[model samples]
Target: MTTTVVIVGAGPTGLTLACGLARQGVAVRVLERAAAHATGSRGKTLNPRSLEILADLGLADGLAAVGRTHLPFRKYFDSAFVNETEPFAGARPSATTPYPASRWLQQPQLEQLLRERLADLGVTVELGAELVDVRQDAHGAEAVLADGRRIPAAYVVACDGGRSTVRKLLGIPFVGDGDPEPMMVCGDVEVEGLEPDAWHQWFGPQGAFMLCPFEGSTRWQLQASPETDAEGRTVPPSLESFQRLAARHTGREDLRLSDATWLSTWRINVRMAERYREGRVLLAGDCAHVHPTAGGLGMNTGIQDAWNLAWKLGYVVRGLAAPALLDTYQEERLPIAAWTLDVTSSGMAAVVKGIETPGIGVEAGGVGDFTGLSLGYGWSSLAGGGATDALKPGDRAPDAPCPGPDGAPGRLFEQFAGDHFTLLAFGPGARPALAGLPDHVRPVALDDPDGEARRAYGITGEALVLVRPDNHLALVAPATAPEQVRSYLEYLERLGA
Candidate 1:
């Protein structure tokens, strides 16, 4: 079958890109090797930035209904109670930042939400379709299934994960170091004698063990330092081993753990692909980069990667921008991946140090900046045209309460809710630039009677702000140069020509 984009993998990254592309009316085919959707509570935290991306996709209400916004860290040292602290304590939603705290929602739950949304967009995930090889040329790419079927597309994205088959097929090197000792044994199991209100952690001299209760459920995610046998090989994780660890670490045999659902061992492996693109075949999510599960960044970073690439891919697939626009995907996300590796590695080191030292508490070491709001593309060539003291090109477009065209209550995010660029005209002086906009650009004239929008955007005078489809600032031109807006769009069209 021929399609515009063939995505390999039905995980969060691939599903997110599929939803974004399908929302923009791009034909997409999602292939997953597994026969059915996998069941695991992997990567439970959805940072604020990821929540904002989902909010733009119109899933904010759905997420809020199911996700827990506040789950304090309840720490314990060797079966004794310590203290509780919430990382995002006192964080409230503001006009500029809507989703302020990280959410506790399991990966499977999120994938289900995305799948439902994708189904609404007339796309479905094709299961049991394992990609054996990929062939790409100047015009298009083809995904070869193990069962002797070929799927052709204009481009292919490898969201297949850390041990990506597509990356290996393309001969891309995954450069990083794997820890000599395995890190932790993790799984989802039914638990009793634990309240589902906080993340329960137990740290001892032998190793640390944690059982974090899932929101609105009786199951808790289990993570414990690996136990090795006589040969010094790490013992594989199982229900029996999990029960033993719970008894040994928490010093309570009454804490019953039963019905082990999913099990796996994790190691500290920090690595990223040397590049994100190989001709028409691009990489995203865990396929492009894999880091330590510190700060709960693994899934959030992948979600952001798909969001950053989706708009560019939509523009290129729809013939609105050049392939050079696709180049910026690597130019922008690669650095963020690198920074993630560095910080997560440090976070992991801190945890390991805490584990080795007595009486030292390790409190989610990589929590800083995990919100991902401060990350941007200011260094990219796509960022240009003026800046304010409060905002600049490549910064995230802040949301504000503004009146719609009918002079009714509205928000900047409502204007940005679909697959379109948003051109914000700060005042009547900047309204002229909103005229003659491209079909994909949505124009919003701000009537800030109380100066709320101006206060949020730091716009003392009239200005025109061109927001990318991903809600990042593309151009911050003066109101006098209305032509700059049109010229910028034309420049984008002519890029890579």
Candidate 2:
């Protein structure tokens, strides 16, 4: 039987993994419990770094089409306006950083776009086929569905959310506590008299309230502190609950909210999985880490987790890399998930205390920190030693205007496209392109006088930059690293073959 990858949960992460694997001709099956596509605005922002990754995956244009194009967030203190500015201001796109600004789209909208792209690759999610149980052995793994059908796969990834049955089945300890009390009641609602120009939030004595207009739709994401009696009892989460909270906090009888959907009493949960993998069954997305929604990092981080794992799995399945390569997924992602939990918790705590602006500095709980541009895996075993101060091994590979294979004006990221490792030789080098690279290793040569790529990459002269499939730098040498490339591939070959 052909080896197939079974992915549970059809959120952005699972679907993205399916898309990446499908493009590589790796057999994959996606199981979503929902009978139909989900609706409502859950995660609404896609940071700059995520846009770049999506652009490489061929979905950036579709996302830009549906997102609220770089809208600023407006803050208020009760009836008094505090300030209004671009949420990701100053992170503008340039020759090197092609997508520097963040974009906002409802989570459902983004998922649909991903599904469409996955469909183009001839893969469709199997809805209503929930994974009931999973068992793994030396050969592979088997997943039993609720419908009493069992399917075998080379590997299984549980992108199934916070209450993941896969996680529970693995007996992974999730150490975290809920806020006990609802910090706020949040949901999407159709409302009038509120402008959809910017994200609006109000802080006052009654409590904090937020009414951000959802772009591309006549709906607003309404968040408000629950009303409590003298006895400290709050009302149940409902449309009436939100209406009362909005009226009491905003004091704007003119503003009205109706047609509520996806209503829920918000609870704070910041937790990480004890382990990301067990034998052939792996955890991803909320199954691996659950962060407070403060930095908008939950979905973005999960998408990246899927991105990182997809390529690694593709390598192992293609027999180009060792199955042991799968271990690096946990080593690289576990720490990131923990750090994200801490940072986002800090952001949320600070916001509640009114100690910092919502979208300002990284430490001040702003876009600068959440963009993921600053994220790197310097500590990972995969990162090779380097001396460049500008672009270190494990750093995010920057994009720049450079010549394509045909010597025409092109972007460096275009070379990084597809399911492959990329070797970028900057300036004059002995080997402009490697002679005996695997079909997956794409190499490009030369540089520009404008010094765009050179400056961005910190390349003085002949330099070799080896970028991973997920666009993180694996090695950086002052000159060509032909031996290094061959050595790395050979290392994997010894284990895989």
Candidate 3:
């Protein structure tokens, strides 16, 4: 088989990349080693940033239908209720922060949603196909499947996992902290006597246990949240262990755990590949960086990796950008991944040290740091500094609930949902200057007396905000200075043409 890109692993990262590419009319093939879809609820929440990305991909409705906002967990100590706390008590929605809530979505549900979306775009996951070998040259790459099928592609991406076959095959050095000890066993199970409203957690001298209701399902996510190593590593989980853990921690014999739907144990992983690309092959998701699962950032970071890479790949494949443009994938995302690891590791360390104040909530997946809203490509060579306010060249394109062309009511995200370079002309004069922009460069003129967008993006006068296909700020130019917009587009033309 032949295609423009061959994606390894069908997790959120790979599926997300596939969808992004396919939507742009790029031929893509996805290979998964497993015979069936996953049952693991590994990544349970899509942080605000991830939610923003999904909204851009036109998945907000589907996610809103299936996913629910997380509620504060009511903590109980021993046999009695102690206090109710929230890891994100202070975090709330505002004009500046549109994605204020986290979507408590199960990983399996998220994947299935992506898969369905991919199917709508004429793509499907090729399961039960394991990569046995890979070979790459200057032109493209070839993969030898375990079942004796050979696939050729212009590029191959590994979203396999922490133990990625692609990363291992490339001999990339994974440099970071060792996996933390006394792992937490996680899975979904049904339990009795727990309120459906608030999540429940019990902390005691020995350890901690919790049962959080998994929205849209009968099961609740069960886990041990102890900071100390009160319990040692055991074998793979069974139903009996879950029952015992629940009975011992909550100190309530009435509550029972049964029918475990998923089971796995994992320690905090702090590692990043030295590089994400080699020859015609690349790595993404867990294959690229494995971090502490704190802040629900691992999967989100990996998904963003795919989000960042897909546009570059699409541009290159369609001869719209230079092959060197692909290099920016590592440049823009690796730092983000490194920063994510540091943040998550620090957060995990806090949990180990019990820094979550008794009455205050714990770190709700780094709710304070914008769950990636603060993440930007400020250090990338691609970011040019000519003008500055709050929204920098490398910052995320902020969303505002405003009107579209001809006073059509819409949000800022609607203009950026498709495959195009979004150009927001904040002034009327600037809109005329961008009137003849290329089809790929979409220009939207905003006339808001309230200056909702102007306040959010810090646009003083007529400003032109160029957003990359992945929705990151590409450039910010003065509306009076059409030369900057012309200059950047010329760069893309030169590289792509």
Candidate 4:
């Protein structure tokens, strides 16, 4: 079978990219090696920026309904109560930023949601289809499956995982540190004698143990430093070891752990691929980079990766933009991946050392910017044009309350929730420039009668702000210079040509 794009792996990253491409009217096929969807409470926190991406896909309200937003950190030292603190105590949504706090939900739940969304787009994931090899030429690519089936596509993306078959097949080296010692053994389990209100943590000389109760469920995620035997080999993670660790750390033997749903040992593996693209094959998510699970950056970063690449892929496959547009995907996201690895590694080290300090481990190396809102691609080749006092090219496009074309109360995000670029025209002078925009660009004139939108963007006079499909600023130009807007779009079309 042939498709526009063939995505290997049906995890969050591949599914997200599939949904984004399908929404833009691009044909997509998602292949997963596993016979069915895997179950685990892996990577439970969705940062605010990821929330924004999901919201753009129209899954915000559904996620909010199932996700827990305000779980406090209940810390204990040697089973003695240390303190309780809320990480996002005063976080509230504002006109400029909605979904300001992280939401805690299982990664599998999110995968199911994405699968449903993909299904809504008339696409279904083909499970048990393992990719054995890939071949590509100047025109297109072909994926050779283990079952002797060959699927052809314009591009093939490897979202399989850190031990990616495609990456290895392409001979891309994964470079970084891999700590031999196990950092922690974690899994989902059924627990009793624990309150389901907060994330409980216990720190002792031996190690640390945490039990975070899943919202509206009996399962709790268990994380504990592994125990060693006489040979100094780490004891494999199991329900018995978990129960023993729970009793020893919390000093509560009655706290029983049973029905382990998933268990695995996690080491400090901080690595990134040498490059993200080769010929017609590309890497994304864990297939591209893997890092320490501190600050909940793993799954969220992968989701953002898919979001960043989706639009560019759609434009290229639809013949609306040059293939060079795909190069910006690496130019923008590779740097972010590098930064994630560095910070998450430091965060893991701090958590291991600062076990006694209240909320230190929970904060994970003082990662106050883990919300991912401050990350931008200002140095990117695609980012150019002027900047306002409060915003610049490659900055996140802030949301503000505005009126729609029908003069009804609405918000900027409402205008941006689609597979199209958004051009915000501030004041009447900028409105004319909105005309004759590309078909994929959606223009919204913000009169800012009450100055709400203008104030949010820090626009004193008239200006034109072009927002990328991923909600990042593309360009900022003066209202009088409509040619700058056209020039910027032309530049993107001819990029890497």
Candidate 5:
């Protein structure tokens, strides 16, 4: 079999990449080792930025319908709510963005929704097939399946995960060690005498315990340090141990454990590969980096990697962009992977080191930082200067609710839902400029998206934001001259075309 891009791993990252490419009318094939979709909610929270991307792919509603939604609060050791933040509160975007706040969702639901979208694009995900071997040359790449079938592709992405077969075959080192103090985590369980609606944790004398609701009925993921050495090394979880721990911490012994779905003993670690690409093969998702789930950032970051790379790869495969443009994947995303490793590792260390302060939230940034919406690529190709008064490139694109030209309130994200550039003309008479944009760019007058978009852009009357395909702001200015607009297009032409 032959394809444009052969993606390994049907996890969120690989699927999202295939979907993004397919949406752009690029041919892609996905290979996964698992026979079916992965069960058990591994990455349980979807950040606001991810929600925006999902919405653009028309998958957000499905995710929102089945995934979890939290009001965003943090409980301290003393049980006092230091600060309950509603970051998504009153989120009225201008024409530049779509979603306002984050959604706490289950990864499985997110994956299922993405799979559906990929199917709609006529892309098929080949599950139960593994990339047992791969060989690359100057012309293209060939991936060998375990069942003796051979597949050819113009390029390949190794989203196979942390212990990736592709990364290993390429002799790339993961280059980091697991956390010195490992936290034993388990999710397969039936709990008794516990609140199922709210996420809870207890910081006690022995150790700490974090219990959060999973998607299914009567299930919650539990994480803690083993009470006894016997349980610590090769722990077989039991109801008694759960009840005893709950009693010791929450002063309640009514908790019961049953029907363990899945449990794993693993430690948090800050690790990244030396490079994301080796010749014609590239690494993404956990294959590129792995961090502790302390911040719920692992899967989200990997999905983001796919989102960032897919469009560029699509352009390259379709002959719209130079193959060298694929190099930007590592240039832009490796820094983010490194930063996530550091941020998540630090957050995990806080839990491990027992940094429980009364009325104090988790570390410097708290849960909001881990949500991944605040990811900044100030050094990216799309970014402008380091900072701006309002919107800037590399920042999460701002969104607003506006009546479309059709007079129904539409989201700013609705404009760039597919493979198109967004020219956000915020000035008075900017519509003419938008109407005149080239075929490669999609123009939407913020004035048309909604009344709030003007305010968000700080445009009392005039300004504009150029949003990239990934929905990150590209450029913000008061008024763009025709020459300036042409110049920006020329930049895209040079970089991508």
Candidate 6:
């Protein structure tokens, strides 16, 4: 069957892209290798910007209901609490964004929630259907499944993991090494003697060890970097090894290992694909870049990629833009990925050097502590290159409370809950300009129309803001100027929409 977009690997990034596309009424197919939805908890936290994305998709309430609101900061040295940043002061949401702070949650829960959203959007996922083969042409790409079913799509997006089958099939060199000097181990096990409410790390003689309590009691994630022996090989991991290390590090001799969920080794590799697109097949997520897990940036960066690409694909499929618009995806996101890799690589180096510095320097309640919302792309076509611009193309578009035209208090994002472009008009005078927009565009006026959005656009008084389907600010105008709007629409036309 032919579809608008065929997404391989129904992980968080692929699933998020599917949902975003489906919400835009674009036909999409998600092929997952797993027999069913994921059950294992992998990722640890969801950044505030991701939460805002979830909120726009209308899944925020469910996630917020189940996820734990992190409230405290606890750092340990030899299993003893040293100094902690005031948890309440760590991160805060912007007055413009609905979600100001980050939340802690399991990856399984997030994937399950995203899958439910896919169902809500009427997009079905083909489980246990792995993409064994792929062939791309000038027009489209055809992906062959393990079961011998061939699916054709206008475009193929590779959201598979680091070892992506599509990526390998395309003969794209991964172009990176494992850690030059590996020094980290990660395993899920049921262990005693740890607090579940906080992330606990213990710096010891040979290397540091960390115990992060899982959702259930007696279950925890034990990660440690053991000293290499004379031959330069660390000891193989086992329950006895973990128990002995725990006792030795924490002075908690009574600790015992009960169940081993997963035992795995980890390394830091900061690498980017030489190119994000190969003909009609494109790559996102870990398939595009792999970085150290210093700030939990891997999955989050991929999700943002999904978000950035989804709407552009939809626009192209709907005959609203030219295909060249797809090129912007790589141009805009690759730099962000490169920057993230560098920052995380530095952070990992600090950790390996046994330097006890903060991952996020701000207090627990401050906005500066999180990595999600603060990332910006200055060189992209999506952002307005205005001085002191509040809403740039590569920056997040903050939401605020506004009254609908019906004179009731409503949220600016609530209007975006559906599949369509939103034309946000600030001040009373911009309403006529919004009304004159094409039928494909949805219009919204601020109840207490202030120039904050105008200020974001480097304008004053009445201004018009064009928001793409994926919530990106396409263009901003000082007033009801149709020329600027038409210019952007023409640009979108050149992109294939």
Q: Which candidate is the best by lDDT?
A: 4
Q: TM-scores across all candidates?
A: 0.98, 0.95, 0.94, 0.98, 0.88, 0.90
Error of 4 at 484 (Å): 1.0
Which window of ten consecutive residues has the lowest lDDT sum in model 4? 359-368
lDDT of 1 by residue, 80-102 (tens): 88778887889999988988998
lDDT of 2 by residue, 172-246 (tens): 998876677777778889888888887777776666778877666898887777878678898776788788787
Report, for all candidates in order, the number of backbone clashes: 0, 0, 1, 0, 11, 24
Residue 173, candidate 5: alpha-carbon lDDT: 88
- Per-residue alpha-carbon lDDT of model 5 for 104-202, expressed as tens digits? 656777788888899898977888897789998999999999999998888989999888999999999898887575566455467777666656655
User: CA lDDT of each candidate?
Assistant: 0.88, 0.81, 0.80, 0.89, 0.72, 0.73
Weakest ten-residue segment in model 5 by summed lDDT: 359-368
The digit string of per-residue lDDT tens for model 4 on 333-376 reads 99999999988888888888878664454676655479999988
Predicted candidate 5, C-alpha RMSD: 3.6
User: Judged by TM-score relative to the true structure, which candidate is superior, 3 or 5?
Assistant: 3
Tell me which of candidates 1 and 6 scores higher on TM-score.
1
lDDT of 6 by residue, 1-497 (tens): 34879999898899899998898788899999889876545676677777777777778778877756563545556556575544435455544765665676767778888999999988878889988999978878899998899998889999998989998999887765666666676677876555577666666454677776655445666778764557988777667677777777667777676676666667677788878888788999999999877666777888888888887777778787788778888888888777777777776665655524433221322212354666665577766523324555555556666676677767667876655778777777777777667766888876565544444445455677777766766666766575677677777786533
10 residues in a row with least lDDT, candidate 6: 360-369
Tell me the TM-score of model 4: 0.98
Candidate 3 off by > 4 Å: 87-93, 225-235, 355-370, 493-497
Error of 3 at 12 (Å): 0.6
Task: Name the lDDT of candidate 6.
Answer: 0.73
Clashing pairs in 2: none
Which of 1 and 5 is the better model by lDDT? Answer: 1
Stretches of model 4 off by over 4 angstroms after superposition: 356-359
